[model samples]
Target: MTSLLSVTDLSRSPDLEEVSFTVERGEVVCVVGPPGNGGATLMECLAGTGEPDAGHIELLGVTVGPGDRRPPGLGAALRGEALPARMKVAEAMRLLSRLYGTRGLPGRLVDLLDLEPLLPKRFGRLTDGQRRRVMIGLALVGNPELVLLDDPTAGLGEGSRRRIEQAVDEVRAAYGGVCVVLDDLAQAERLADRVVLLRAGRVLAEGTPTRLIKLLGSTYVMGVPPHLRVDGLRDVRVLRGAAATYLYGSRPALEAAIQDLSPMSGDRVWSIRTPTLRDAYLTLSAVPEPAALEA
Candidate 1:
């Protein structure tokens, strides 16, 4: 019942206005916001990576210092930067051995990250997925109470992304700690128990993903089901209040839908977007539809 991280009246002016949230132990809170809207800054503040101009952060029942953006040392290193490319994977990990003051059980790390067969490989030799796993292993090695991941699957392939997501779930289950994932709705939905939508640095809404969908009046999605074809229409009336967007390839169809349906100039008419994580991402972060934008 104890709160792990509490932000009371937190404000990072010129950016984050006033922000506040409590991340209890064992909760995965996903924060989604527009680009350049301070989502990362908020995550850094919560993760002790950056300070808030005005706010108190209490972590694990203790008050932590203001945000520190000092040059990244261990985290960056584990992020797979700064290491000598030729260095053996084991050697790269061992470099931190002295700093951590523990001969980290490399074998265990390998096991936990499923890198046993990859231990002897050099940093330059591993595939993209293997490298990602290494960075993740290093980041979570300390076993902190609250873990923050910023765009954890930004560049990886679909298969690699799937692995990273599974790892996130494993970490949370293993630690029973709060994890705040900072990513677009695509990545966050995989791990979030609840999502907080931010706008101009302030929380616009907070609830479970399903609740957010309902709030946005999103369409029912069943994961890549067969496509629906609305034959030859100048316009088709959109289901009242559903948030779909017009997208590529269906231009002719969308035009037809619009032609057949009577649309008020002021009515907000959104076309269906391509089916992808980004579509869900857009829908996931949509602002409350204004009466004017709807047209």
Candidate 2:
């Protein structure tokens, strides 16, 4: 199937290098990476807000450029300040609809996003999380064929995050196109049909979440007391935190290593049954796990 959005060898300055990917219609693609790793820069380049020093981008089969023309039938909300400070929330929403020539704005969106209470408030007066809801709602105003959300839930409380996530889900259900950019790994795992993992200004890995999680295999984690001396432990990778040393590996090997501990009843212990997308990310990024650090 032809891609709805295709990026070829995209790069910019010291931030991005030869990044490339494709997004199919009705798919939600999440970009994940650490700070300054190009996730946000990728979004800006896609939204036409920033220019790429090299490479090309195609949205709906047309090349994107520095020209004033915006991609037709595409919607986006990028980082930085949002909305005119003095504009009321309701006015901002309506003005966006007018700009897109969208009529009969769905009342369900108002309720779905719980926008009623904030309607009369000015954009500058709303909290960061509230402004995020507005930004998401604004992106959906024209019911565009594609939407790009950059850190939509960044800084939100639990309730607000769920509301924004629900709005994203509704967009896919209603329009069947979305590319959600997120810094949070767990959120990416939950919402992504495909994931693009970036590190040090490059695309380190890209694939389905399930496939990526399997990169670490069927792993198990054993949490032992922080002070426990695990340097002598064999056939296990360990991640040490302030409270515990997390040892993980294939099931049988990990279990055998745990038995070697010969633990008493009071020893702190826990287990992670499935390897998560975050685990795969850390492995790919070459993070300094305890075992690697000791080596």
Candidate 3:
């Protein structure tokens, strides 16, 4: 199969360092790295929004050498005021569609994003979730062969999140493109075909989420809902929505929760490890930064 995007000996300046990766046609390549490690910069470079100090960026098999190249429709990504706050949802999308000569940008996007009824609402009147969906639709409207998404599901409720996840899948399936999404590991696992672990702007380990978790050993062969048994833990403190409570037990909260809800509660056994993307991420970027947590 032909590779849609490839970066050989791809290195960025003093900050990004040496980087290399590839995305074949119809594949999702997620670049996962700890915060403050230049993941955002990579997106900017790949999307032609920012210049990389040095590196070769290939898009659709065409070489984009040094300095960001404004690939056909990439210019719109850097437009100021991502969405027109004063414009009605329908009106704004229509304008963008016309500008790009791509009709149905708004009406079809509304359905894809579950925003059919929201199209009538002015941008300012929409809720945060509504706004997010609209913005995402516009971002994808350019028919980009490569999409860079930062926290795609941020600020949305669980139901909305599932929808966003499904939308992402559809985008890849229909567009035959590569979408680089940045988010917690859980989100990555849900959307990515492969994971690239990075640290301080360098690739550390790259593989499927499950393989990385195992390579990480007991460090993160763990995690679950707020309340679950954690392997090799005497106790755990779960901090959710600002209130911190300690779950003290001989096992992880997941194991305990399982036993508590078991059909044979009287003879029940243990817990569960949901294996989220966040779990894998922390393991790849773990540095015992307790002091930073307080900061």
Per-candidate TM-scores read 0.66, 0.88, 0.70
lDDT of 2 by residue, 175-285 (tens): 457887788999999988889888877887888898887666556666677886777677788777776666778778777766777564346364646677877777667
RMSD to the true structure for each prediction, in A, is 8.3, 4.5, 7.7
Worst 10 residues of 2 by lDDT: 286-295
Residue-by-residue lDDT tens digits, candidate 3, 1-295 = 5566766555567547767777665667777765777677777677666677766777776778555454664322321234566789878777777776786454554666887887788888887777777777776666666655665665579877777677667767865555564646666776777776666777666666667655433421222344433334334333232222122223454354444445433453433344455554554454442111100
Residue lDDT tens for model 1, 63-154: 76674433222132122233456777667566656555556534544565676676688878888777777767666555545655665666
Preferred candidate (lDDT higher): 1 or 2: 2
Q: Which candidate is the best by lDDT?
A: 2
**Top candidate, metric TM-score:** 2
Give each model's whole-structure lDDT.
Answer: 0.56, 0.79, 0.60
Query: In model 2, which regions exceed 4 Å deviation?
Result: 223-246, 262-266, 287-295
Distance (Å) between predicted and true CA of 65, model 1?
2.3
Q: Supply every candidate's count of residue pairs whose N, Cα or C atoms clash at under 3 angstroms.
A: 22, 0, 14
Ten residues in a row with the worst lDDT in model 3? 286-295
Residue 89 CA error for candidate 1 (Å)? 3.2
Ranking by TM-score: 2, 3, 1
Model 2, residue 25: displacement in angstroms?
Answer: 0.9
**Candidate 3: stretches off by over 4 Å:** 9-14, 65-69, 73-81, 106-109, 216-295
